[model samples]
Target: MKHTYAPIGLYSLCKPLLFRIPPEKAHKLSLRALGLAGSLPPARYVLKRFFSPDTQSLSLFGHTFINRIGMAAGYDKNAQALDGLEGMGFGHIEVGTITPKPQKGNPNPRVHRLPQESALVNRLGFPNDGLDIIAKRIESYCNRRNKRYSGPRPILGINIGKNKTTANAQAYLDYKECFTRLKDVADYITINVSSPNTPNLRALQSEEELEKILTPILDIRQKSASHVPILVKLSPNLEHNTRTGMIQKLVEWSVDGVILSNTTKTSHPWEGGKSGAPLHDATLSLIQETRSRFPNLVIIASGGIGLDGDLQTFIEAGADLIQIWTALVYRGPYLLRRL
Candidate 1:
């Protein structure tokens, strides 16, 4: 007798049908399906076999991840579907670019797909269910850890961002709020300052501003009885020198890790931030430059990683871990399994 895995095939067949709908709607539907499928024991086992990676373990920031492959933030905005995602073989799942308060985000049509380029453009503005809600969800998920599951639990990385409407001067407060709430449950925290959708958000990446924001956050983390690792997400569009300087600042601040290159805002042939194939060069360059300067820093490469070759490039470029969101959208869950 032979066993068959049909969901991936079915998903490939149904993708065109899903694509006919709005991109965001398709995304929500996919997420819903993942959540439902994960809840089912038999289906989850099949998915784990098909998508999960059997690889050597990795140690970073004092925690061990099942594998180097992780789901980038923005997929599970409210931390709702982590178990489902883990069931699909992601070693680490980063949820949310969450804010202190609930926000509606930019508007409809914020997420656009470019099938020709196998990429996506999103200006979601970090809309989330707020830090309090996200914290509760994570706590609940952790509480259910004793329950049986198909595979090992995935590491949870919570990515925090300022609310779109929040004032820049008050941004630290928002980040602190989320950190305080999610610290106990999150395996790590990613301080996101790279998204281009929010007004004046990227400005925080500057040395002067970043110092002010990070100093207090770092203090809070140090003072806490439970210490959680912190990583900062950087933009790929910044000049190489600027990116290097940011890395240096991160090292000086004693940040635990760095996510090299978020979505690129440069729109050459495609709209939105150029991801996938287009971002490979810039992302690789940034990673290499940062690695050269800060060899000890934990580097999680994010941009342009869609294939094994791209993953190899990042690893060679000195990345400690790798993440993919656009690739998962373009290539489906099989990419995780393959990696």
Candidate 2:
């Protein structure tokens, strides 16, 4: 069995100091540390040995996931930390909210930490290195690892979104471009229509607008020799009827899966979406409702998953997979093995 002990010693010592820095800067620093460690073979091995989860394997979408846990999309937005993150024991590492063109996201002081709530409110509007550069990064990362390590590595999921400059009518072009460019390197692709920071991006969740986005993408999927599972990340604040209607449309279109939620729009004294403990109830409710309604649809539950109890509760509520972001901020890498 996997160890349940949370390794908090060093992280506890470092948390306060790290927290003292601005959230986004701290985030970049953390990823840079891991990226540096990953670039060295000996360091990568040691990190992997210490942090890797020993869990039963799961097969989904023609790939093997070594564990149920994945690092969610927004954290590694540019795909820069894949090797280091994989070394730290996530069964999957999702990157991006990447757009067709490189763009600066929301301005600084965008990501705020709520230490007491263990939550984050970010309007970091999909800041990324764009599709072309990130795709090469992923491709290069996979190539380097394939040549060096023969053991299991984390599954790569590329999450794509439209550029801020793109109008709602032309959004499908951006998604199509990203899907086409990224399909080769990705084990799966997630369509991000749910981030509250992006204006009118959530508007695509409407059945009519969504069909516009999916039709061409599905056509490409059918024609391509390779198959990549496509998933949609949704907002937690979606109304009952709207959410259900969207899922039903996803089913009809034969989309592969759905990420139960992104974050909540309940950011008070802030302008972005809220994540962490506050999102747990909504995520759980969405997973149960979706599972009960569509027994076979793949459900990747994200939001408010930090503790061991939260992990178990989500799975029990019918989450086929779980992704973590805020939890990593609050609890550190040790939370992976603890779960």
TM-scores for all candidates: the values are 0.92, 0.96
The total of clashing pairs for model 2 equals: 0
Instruction: Give the per-residue lDDT digits (tens) of candidate 2, residues 1-339.
Output: 111223264788888899899999999999999999988879888887877777767998889998899999899999888889988889898999999999999888899987767788999999998998999999999999899768877899999999999999999999999999998889999999999998999989899999999999999999999989999999888889999999999999999999988988855878898888777776788899889999999999998877676667888899889999988888788777776
The candidate that wins on TM-score is 2
TM-score, model 1 to reference: 0.92
lDDT of each: 0.80, 0.88
Q: What's the C-alpha lDDT at position 9 in model 2?
A: 48
What tens-digit string does per-residue lDDT give for candidate 1 at 1-339?
111122244458766787799988988888888887777878888888887777668788888888888898889998777668978878789999889989998878778877766667887788889888888888877776546644556889999999887899988888878887888788899999999878888888888877877888888888888789999998877776777787788888888988977887855443355556556666777788778878798999887677655566688899999898877776678776554
CA error at residue 254 for candidate 2, angstroms: 0.7
What 10-residue stretch in candidate 1 is worst by lDDT? 1-10
> Over all chains combined, what TM-score does candidate 2 have?
0.96
